[model samples]
Target: MRIRHPGALWRGAQAAALAAAVCIGGFGTSGEARAEYADVVINNYSDAAGMRPVIFPHWFHRIRFRCKVCHADLGFQFKAGGNEINMVKIIDGQFCGACHNGDIAWSVENCNLCHSGKPGTPTQVHESTIQKLAIQPQAGGQQ
Candidate 1:
């Protein structure tokens, strides 16, 4: 090809580099580009049904909506493992289904998105609220 527009080739290369960076950076080792461990793991009925535990990203949801959205409006209990969440309830527009029913968010059809945790994991809070709020030790043992 004739070297008519040399600058065009540089622009194309830059565009390619940017695209590659975005594609690679958009994903993490796990599925989403967020924390390594989920905020909450719901394994109440997953093990019995031969399915992976449900990894709920509380942090992700908290950033988008207030606590009342799920706690009060959705009737989800404040304590972990308190609410009896299941596929039936979710599909019937209860609990998670209230929002994840293809209207507000993704429906139950996307199983792996929620149940992406390792097998045999128990239902509990992955991260502790106290730990997050606790003051960390300063460098060199200084408070």
Candidate 2:
């Protein structure tokens, strides 16, 4: 049957053409263009301590562990600042403490490792990576 709304068909064609042009140039759908591992900065709850925000680099962690190790086993919320981690919880062997204890990567005593004394570091990384990703195309069709 012939479609009655010709404008709808024209709009759909225009959208498809735009999407094709975008894909041909390298950027996929918005989801594909986004970074696979983004750095999460936890500062909303830590600013009171006068400490810099913790910049958790997902790319670094992804190198050694699977996503399930933290997302599923440790129960970390996927959203940034969603877990509400703090020093007390870390000392109690919760959240980051689950792995950062002396027996593992590094003890909480080494504060400078996570807290770089500069809140802007993580923000800069995130912004730069995002800008780069927007311009550069990924190696494969996948993210």
Which candidate should be chosen as best, given TM-score against the real structure?
Answer: 1
TM-scores of the models, in the order given: 0.63, 0.59
The lDDT of model 1 is: 0.71
Candidate 2, RMSD to the unseen true structure: 9.3
* Runs off by more than 4 Å, candidate 1: 1-38, 129-143
Q: What clash count does candidate 2 reach?
A: 0
* Residue lDDT tens for model 1, 3-108: 4597988878776766675576442232122343438877778878989888888879988899988989989997667898888888889999998989989888
- Whose lDDT is greatest here? 1
At residue 3, what lDDT does model 2 achieve?
48
Give the alpha carbon lDDT tens digit for every residue of 3-121 in model 2.
46988788788767666665674433343323344766556544566777777888899999999999999999876677777889999999899999998789999998888524422
